[model samples]
Target: MITKILQYYRGFVRARIVSHSPERFLNLCRNHQIILQDLVYRDGYYECQMDLKDFQRIRPIAHKSHTRLFILKKCGFPFFLYRNRHRKVTYISCALFVIVLYVMSLFIWDIQFEGNQKYTDDVLMTFLHSQGYVQGMKVHNVVCEDLEKAIRNEYEDINWVSARIDGTRLVVKIKENTGILEIEEKNYEEGDLIADKDGVVVSVITRKGTPMVHKGDTVSVGDVLVAGTLEILDDSGGVMAQHRVQADADIILERTYEYNDYIPATYIERNYIKERKHYFIQFFDYRFQIFPVEKKENTEIITTKNQCHLFSNFYIPVYYGSCQERIYEETEKSYTETEAKQLCERNLQYYFKNLKKLGVEIIQNNVTIKWDVNGCTANGTIVVHEKAGKLSQEQQVEETMKANEYH
Candidate 1:
């Protein structure tokens, strides 16, 4: 039966062609032993169909002619089934996606905050959540302007703030308050300089206090410079009150450290592969299912969960992503002291380089220590060169240190 249908379709198949010269068209087809079927003459072209056999017969001449032909072929059932599968999935998925997107458009899945440096993300999110702008809330149910006004009224440290909905996450940007303290300058006092470390005196700069030593003066740790002359003969030939000042100086020292390590013969390593699967119900972004979700110990292995939403089409997610985690763990064997010291030295040098930025110059450095039967430990002292001047009280954020005042 299918063969007969195909034969009929082939016998009267429809097509179109263009030919400028009628005589040439007739001669060309005749030369190729082909027949013309259901011919038309309009717009310099013919519209018609032809049997495969007839078309093949004239195919040779048609190849040489300036004219062109287009044939309308019938679709077979296999072709129809194949196309229908794609169209069906697309149509059904699209239809479901639309309804789902509309419903999901009303709900919120995530919230985010940006442009916040002073406050942690958790803190900002907590504040936002208390304001009714949290995840899983209906997106269309809240007005963000009112929320911002409320937040500004509640938090004095915030100068300016704004909230926006980007897909499922609400991005809250904020500016923090910065104001200088109001203080009046007072009468000044002079102080002395004391040795912070055991080193040779290099040089000292006394702003208000008198200097005690010049360059190349050796000093022990805790030695004082710039004596506070309290009972001094003034120009009036009388004893005058002593004044305190800060004796500032730069001191550098040499230091050393070492590390010990033990080598292990075997090591343990862990590897992971990700398997992703997603399911939907009613083609909406309302709910989801994840397998093997039971919480357990040895969570050392971290599992990250990400969620995305689609408000436009169910098949294409438009919302930003979210992630949750589970921890994974692996232990590797240890190495010998030489290997450990190399590793420790690499890290130690990295840290020491940062300390140099604090204005301390290193005159010399040495590292000597190792761990074998037990863990490694190191011990060393720093020696710097600097001069001393009179000291004063320096007030700072944490604690106030007094120099000449201590004496």
Candidate 2:
């Protein structure tokens, strides 16, 4: 492939040799170190392609072989230039286009992110913009090591980051910490674990602090499940001092979640009439239309764009593709009883799926859906077993101690 490209750049020719001694001619050409491509014989004549320089050296060989050479076809850059030499303006425009492309290549045209889970592309791009790194910035200004460090410092969950420049694109790859995050012991402030929802305690395991509730105990929102202060005792069993620490515990509880959802019977449905397609070419911000676009009401335009690139990762700002306009009409429609019930069930299932994603174990689903002429309604309670505590300030421990002293 590379040889062919070089041949085209240097120009080449196909010549027919009317020689009685074709074998001798070929041997003489080879002995003279001449390269011939696409050699063939047909109807008592020989034809082959050779570079212009080699063709120039072939005249003496042809004369010795008693052969006549005829230039059948000329191809490649030199011939193209000679044929279009009169079109000076076209040549100038082409040179200008190449120069523009080269200039654009010095600046970043696209910014891409990979291996991101918790943070989205927009979030990362926004951060980069705030740090004065953005698309169209000079590629030479990008310090990949600094960018990686900045990203790692900015996002706590990002465990590893790699930033690199690929052609005209800034590519950032990050690996997020998927394991459970642990708080540093030095940063653990005095706090107590309190119930964030109403539930019956299934189990309690304390890692630090005094347990205020036990298994099978009923708890309400804001009630302390574990106290952050421990009562230290003297030899005589009197309280010597109260040592304050952060409360750490896992409390599983059986809770009921109230679920309610409804959907209207009447809805708007779209009926597509026809689809019209138009092609467009875009250079940076300017767009040129290849086909005339018609203006119509109640139409949805879906466009697919493909950016121009020299190869992988060498993207440019030029884009071209097709836009499809789907013309549609809206009509008022009513769902049947069965359809309404099915939709309500689907919504209920989605709610359950979300709850399961949060590590909730559904014990029982008592929810039911009913459909009437007006709409569908789902109402009931979902029984689930889930972790049920959040950190709260340690003021509750002091209050509990005062209450104990009063008693």
Candidate 3:
């Protein structure tokens, strides 16, 4: 491979020689120190390859050997240049393109995360950016071990992490401790089951310990739903032996979430104008915005940035895009009753979505819309059924100390 590559750069030629005595021609060429390679004997001629300089020297030897020599092919940089001499501009552009690619390869252009179930891409990217790992950063400066250590230090749930560079892209792989319990859940193992929030218990099923609160019971935050005491009763319902354990129970509650929002009849509406100005520079994976834009008062600016890759998908160091700053002006606008109601409904729905994310199952949603002269007011009461119990570690410790003192 090395020899072939060097031959391409230094230039070489393939030629055939016909002689009455081929052995004599070969000996003459060797005696004159003319280098030859891949020599093959055909019906009446000897075919071989040699360096460009050797090819020039071969003619004199062929004359002495009384042989006929003809170039079968020319292969190398010199020949290539001669063949495309008229298209020098095209060749120079291609050379520049390769140089640009080399320069771009030195910088990191993309960051990717994998095996991340709990953390989001934005969350990981933001963390990476905060650690000086971002697009356009020098690839050499990135230390994968340092990044992995930093990530492990910052996120306790992550058990293992790996940061590696693939071309211009940085890939982060993480293995999180998904089986780990939450703080409240772990506390519950060592204490009585208490109410996490104020709610009406809809159902209660005790697995261990004694049930303190039954179904349809109203419990406040910190109130024990199940006691950790296990009582042993004799024939006459007399307490003989008692034991304390970690209480366990499944308590579903009907919790209500109230959200109040008022939408103004007259509000400022912002709209971006399509006119924009952009200036950008790109070489390989490097990108820079030449023109800096500012947001004017009472206006919103939207800047869109994009990077380009080679062959549409293959990432190279070359990037081409424009930052379009769409200037938006705000104007006073009045909302109709119907529009205000829709906005209020959207707000309520957004609140419900957030609740659902917490594993709350919505049993009923009651939203009351009040239309005032100025605007509309929406009051929402979302009744959700969800597990309702939390363990108070401090209280559990206090209770244990008190029981020890009493004993």
Candidate 4:
């Protein structure tokens, strides 16, 4: 019949028994008319705790009656006291050491790197450190824009670079540049319409010069569509110095159509062999690109990977890895007349799209191809007249940079 109210104190009940005689201690209290009371342990000894008022009345007969000690809790459970001072001290020390070790790891010491193709992770780490983001350098030392610029400048051979910090890992990625473009555009003044492709001249509008063709006229691709200037001369009709100009033209093309019939169709998967990326290791402002060495040929690739700069702060992760994917489609040649025709149509459509940007209109097109039991060959000509205007904004912006700038 115990209630939970008394449980909070871990209270237990015991009947007090004090007897020198073992038999007396074993004797039942009620049978012997002995008093029953509470008991407690003190200093390795049991003390009978009777009410003071009751104690006085029972004190006289206490020696005659054997005192009994019996627990009153519903379940008489053995108790445990706190001990083992040495064990507790050892546990606390071990826990403290582990926490200290973990906190220390938060401070990176040495950074390592891997999965690099063009540049070594160590080189990037050293460069980053020199750029104020090295071992012992607080994370805030490298700004995103600054890091991006630094990587670009340091690794000229890499066409692109990216840098970031993931947890303690700093990833710097580099891509090799694979494009080789003509450095300059040829300059021209005024010239006559020539036959680049036999085509009829349609319409022509001169933007900054004079027109050389009107609608319903036949011309070629290289045929001059516009004149760069007006003819100026002295009183004697002598020629003057010609000024450089962007001769505009819109020469409608002349074309032919021929066809060959055949059977059987084939499909093939093609891979592009051209790709570009730039990777570098920069120390302070100076940088080096290990990949994209001179005398390399046909650099197209499918994927480019890079990692963040490694540093001496944490040897575990110098930088995370990154990659870019590029896919190329091969030009398929089909023996089927219908499929070949579709392919040629698509090609012409794409060509028209490009010509539209040049102020040219493709009013009509005639296509024909030759086919045999072996295969089919398409022989066709595009009739387009285009005019030249101002250079594209992007091109002008690029032209403004006199030289490649680096940090």
lDDT of 4 at 330: 72
> What is the TM-score of each predicted model, taking all chains together?
0.37, 0.62, 0.63, 0.28
Superior candidate under TM-score, 2 versus 4 = 2
Shift in Å, residue 122, candidate 3: 7.7
- Tens digit per residue, CA lDDT, model 2, 322-388: 8899999999999988899999999888887878777789999999888888999999999999987
RMSD for all candidates, in order, please: 15.8, 8.0, 7.3, 20.1
Q: Candidate 3 residues 9-68, lDDT tens each?
A: 999989888889888988888898888899998787789999998887877778887999
Worst 10 residues of 3 by lDDT: 398-407
**Candidate 1 C-alpha lDDT tens digits along 361-398:** 55555545566654454445433322222234454223
Best by lDDT: 2
What Cα-based lDDT does every candidate model obtain?
0.56, 0.88, 0.80, 0.49
Which one wins by lDDT: 2 or 3? 2
Worst 10 residues of 1 by lDDT: 313-322
lDDT of 1: 0.56
Once model 3 is optimally superposed onto the true structure by TM-score, how far is the C-alpha of residue 264 displaced, in angstroms?
A: 1.1
lDDT of 4 at 244: 33
Query: Whole-model lDDT for model 2 versus the true structure?
Result: 0.88
Indicate the TM-score of model 3.
Answer: 0.63
